[model samples]
Target: MKTAGGDAAAKRRAGERAAEEVEDGTVVGLGTGSTAAYAIEAIGDAVADGLEIRAIPTSFQSRQLALEVGIPLTTLDAVDRVDLAIDGADQVVDDPDATAHGTLIKGGGAAHSREKLVDAAADRFVVVADPSKLTARLDRSVPLEVLPDARTVAADRARVLGGEPTLRAAERKDGPVVTDNGNLVLDCDFGAIESPADLARDLSAIPGVLEHGLFVGLADATYVGTDDGVEIRAY
Candidate 1:
């Protein structure tokens, strides 16, 4: 069946849940991207309605959005810990539990380096996505963050893993879009990652790999907003 307003509706449901999950005086890790943008706005609405919480953003974009939405801001350096981190994913899986895999492919906005760091600092990670993002297998859409000088080298290494690696599509004509940490990104196609953890490990072992957008079994659960309604998947 065709999903009605698929992406937009799914994002709205996820953002609503994210906003409802916060508590007074809570510390949260705000994520980046279009879906996370909604999550930020939902939290802001909550704040405007008297749900006060301090949010530490994972990227510059996130920070700005959070500010614009009226979510109180702080730095990870200033905050001791995050109660939870709400983010989005490019794809998920049929397994509701691992629907999106605790692991994820992020930095679609080129924030992988910092996003990874912030994720490492969070205690709980929640990924929100539309049902369409759920897949039976991971595929060509893998996003890889690499050092500029080692772009070709990294692409070659990814080929050793049975995938073709291409530079991430750049929106700007004058320059490749630089990540928040100054790294360049390559979108790789590994087809189906039988062992995402192993793949993530291999990629991480590479010298020039700043971070691969793969979550590698890091998520506890995912909330999928389907055409019918919201479904909770635990993994």
Candidate 2:
């Protein structure tokens, strides 16, 4: 089942199938974003079906979803390792967009911050998405998370990398936009990222940087959900 850009019901079903794939007693990493929302529900449904997995969330939102799904949950600090990461992507460059799978432009929902951490701790990062997000290359619209004080510096650094960094803004219920991590978001247009791994490493080496939206070696495989089904990618 594909969930990209689909209604909530499709997302829910797709997420359910992903969660169903997890083996019992595995420490699973949960991701954020609308597509992830389905995975969360699936995990919960699996729990309802008597499958028990320790889920580590990528964000507060994921944490809440864990609880909502009734999936036994723990934090990364509480767990030693993750066996699998079942999450969603925003854009996939390889195929058409659908509810089941595709390339993804993730982290728009602000789960990128912890998503990287979860992926690092995991043995595998199974990216779930629809086809529309797949593309010829990665880093079309990259997201960066930086220290509140060093946002500009980070932006400048991205510009140096041939990226156009723009502060992510939103109309808050009261005032400012609130990121999922309760921080700010910046969108960087790097056009086509040829070397995603190297660029991600460079960003991490910089100071005052928290985390970027880029997922480098962290991903073991990407699963795209198309109108037909899931397509798997790996290096």
Candidate 3:
């Protein structure tokens, strides 16, 4: 088993590598999550060194981090295009047939709805992950941000699609975890997903589901951190 420190180091490796992709005078989409945090810090360091760029953060967490690191922020509405996006995944699996590195399961932070928007808008989306996130198949629970009033109905619909939906409860709070968008999250488990695209479609079709965690055909590349070093995979 990998220690927390080792995992953190690996995450830093991948994240910093992904940050290197950013260029001057570009609008970057900053992603959320622990791994992505490192990328944000790396970009901040670059900015301090005179790498001129603007950023559109995917979540409140990312926005705060960017501010702390002195990275200039912008709104999506103000930008015509995002040059690149760097993000992390809960799980990533290789798909030989796809143009990207593979499929990704995200939203462990309950920020998938916004993350998807920024990632999709970017000219290129790069995923950063540690070895632990890599898998032969995406079996991790898929996070779905649902409208608060439609949580129960969305759960029912998710079950009809063959998933076991569970409301994500808060760790310290009393009720369920609320997303930044004022939505609830349903973590739907589908064992081992055979076709991620089909499941994504079905999940999206469900009413009140703002977004699901299956990121299909969005990643342009992946940087995986391993014990030896960082491995770069391009699609």
Among these predictions, the greatest TM-score belongs to 3
- Best of the two (2, 3) by lDDT: 3
Candidate 1, residue 200: the lDDT equals 82
Worst 10 residues of 1 by lDDT: 93-102
Best by lDDT: 3
**Clash statistics: count for each candidate:** 8, 40, 0
lDDT for model 2, on a 0 to 1 scale? 0.70
Residue pairs of candidate 3 with colliding backbone atoms: none
In order, the Cα lDDT scores of the candidates are 0.76, 0.70, 0.91
User: What is the lDDT for 184 in model 1?
Assistant: 83
Model 1, residue 13: distance off in Å is 0.9
Q: What lDDT tens digits, residue by residue, belong to model 1 across residues 5-101?
A: 3478777787667657778888888887776777788889889999878988888989988888888898889988888888877766555444335
Q: Model 2, 1-235: lDDT tens per residue?
A: 3433645454454555576668888999988877677778777877898887788888887788778768888888888788998877666545223222223456677667788778777887777655555666675677777777788788888888888988777755654345665666678888877666667778777676677777654555665555545556763
Worst 10 residues of 2 by lDDT: 95-104
TM-score of 3: 0.95
How does each model score on TM-score?
0.90, 0.84, 0.95
